[model samples]
Target: MAQNPAGASAAGKPRTLAGRCGSANWVCVAQCIDVTCVDKCLAEGCEQALDALAQCAEKSGCGPDDSACVSRVCGKQCGRTFEPAPPSPEKETTDPCADASVGAGKVPEEVVGRWTLEAASIRPEERPRLAGQEEGVDVKPRPDFESALVVTSGGCFLLRTKLEDATLGRGNTLEIRSWGAFQVDEKKDTVQVWTKSGQAVGPVCGKPRVIGLSKGKFQRPVYTYDVEGDTLTLTAQTPSRQTFQFRRQTQEQKEQAE
Candidate 1:
């Protein structure tokens, strides 16, 4: 019998085709053409074509000795082409919160107590002058108002204010209540309050109107504090720069007043 180019005997002969062509190439040839054609092609020197088909099969992610891939790539190498698969889509990311803490902070133990507002005053330079008023003259009259502050040990606070409304009838008061959490830095002598909720109940526009306070209107009401005996003085550092003197209230006094 004549020796094949692959160094294997013809089919039905003693020698097998395993060593001459690798398992993958043998499978590819078997899938693409008949055994007689494989022997003839090898005899005719089709080694270069077989090598190119194997390379195309590797690039197209064909399984080792895959019969289906051999049939598709080798049998149709003349007209068919192969391309790599597309990548998968990426997952969407989550959005972050604007303010996760919302100004949450700790309050010092020394300043955690109920304080009654004794007096409130504004500096002459900080006060806005009246229209057409003389430079040295101070004509703006102060509004009659009273306020009280309560600071709990749990870092919470409440501020209640009652101002006599001159526009409304006599004895009519504009009552305002604000409550929130407080943060204090004793080393810096500064204290700040985060107003979470508030409301106003009084006569306005010819009727008794209860209006909710604009939450977070006072973004940063920072104040420098000084405690002397039973008195605590808080001087505002932003917004309306004013001084507020408060007297510490005893539990008996608070109960009696309430």
Candidate 2:
């Protein structure tokens, strides 16, 4: 892993693959993030950090095909080829609940439900990054988040809140049923949801001042159905414009034995 160059970032963040993933409750997601960081060249083992970052940008998610990656990484002066993430069992899921029970909600809610935010330093005026993730250090400054969470039917919510261990997140503080409603456009299949409290939700001290959800407004949210094998990615931005991602979870309840 890489660390921030001295006198550069005051908060000495990891500049390499080792320190990127902050905290992941799921095995697959964490592994994917590690792969993504390597693909991004954020890890230090690569020598030149920017060159590595540029090279990594060209890998996996940013690439068009298995070989092509983002121009930034590909265009780096370094004479090298960015290898793609090899196929792995980490991609397999036998649990029926991995996807939604409808037409396009194939994303796993449990994976998609919650997020672990480390920092969101982007400004809204800048090009908005996608709602997804990478790995990094644990949060330092806690933040404030909405009091309510929302979810679709046959679904449940999962989130790492902003409240500290002293207040909202104290003993028995997490309430699974304490969720907000997602307004879905039934006709168009679009959807939006909001926090019942403030726009920001989560630890009061974490970076990324706000974890704005993928579906921006509380009005409508992009929905999921029974689309098979489709990946669901949701990024949240806080007031400070930090970014985070979540993979949606789904499942099928057994019909009562008549």
Candidate 3:
């Protein structure tokens, strides 16, 4: 019967009790991520999971401000783990550059530059077969497709891609561009992208149109990258893991700025 921040039920019942959930209930919600709570609910066959979650907050008796209860009693009893609390400032070193260098990979310095995608391929085993193709065929981007990844000095990255496919029709290609902040882990040889914003340019109803990306916040498991000579290869985990091979853009390409 009450309204919550996420809105209300069609029948005027509370859709979410988040506002009324005590600190304990909120703690359980955080831990339910990646857990088999839904499966557990199905097994129980009666919304026992929901009842358990609601009971967490109801029994805690902690006030809205008492977040400590989440860890000290509620979360622990609920068998959920919160990401470890961040180290206190006093416990952390005062070096400002420490944060910058911490995850920088073994050769983070090598990642800073303009790189152009030469090829992209997906593992055959993980992807569906193309029409008239064999069951295990690794798919590669068409020759006309163009992609570039530029990493600047201060952890900023820009990605641009263009593709020409028969499916889209003759003389028409789709262009996609996105920019975001990124962090590199040198030890892990990985990169993570965040805060992505971008747009797509393509034909719509026989005319060119530009449309913005609907995603505001984006992130994924760290992508692995390898560099050799002027070549860079980035492997990302998608529905099927994909590998994108790139080459450092030459002065000529930079000047042309396609």
Top TM-score prediction, candidate number: 3
Scored by lDDT, model 1 comes in at 0.45
| Candidate 2 lDDT over residue span 144-203, tens digit each | 321112243444332223232222211101111112334344454433342221122222
Highest-scoring model, lDDT = 1
Error of 1 at 53 (Å): 99
Residue-by-residue lDDT tens digits, candidate 3, 1-258: 000111111212221222221122221211111112211212222234334533564577766445455334454332321111222122212122224432223336678788876655534433343456765444344465556676765676656655442312232344555555567777788777643445545542233545444222233345687889998877764444556677899999987754
Clashing pairs in 1: none
Residue 246 of model 1, lDDT score = 80
Each candidate: what lDDT? 0.45, 0.26, 0.44
Q: In candidate 1, what are the lDDT values of residues 111-187, reduced to their tens digit?
A: 76778766555334423533355433422223554456766656666665554523112322344555666678778
* Cand. 3 Cα-lDDT: 0.44
Candidate numbers, best TM-score first, in rank order:
3, 1, 2
Off by over 4 Å in 2: 1-121, 125-150, 154-160, 165-178, 194-231, 235-244, 248-258
Of candidates 3 and 2, the better by lDDT? 3
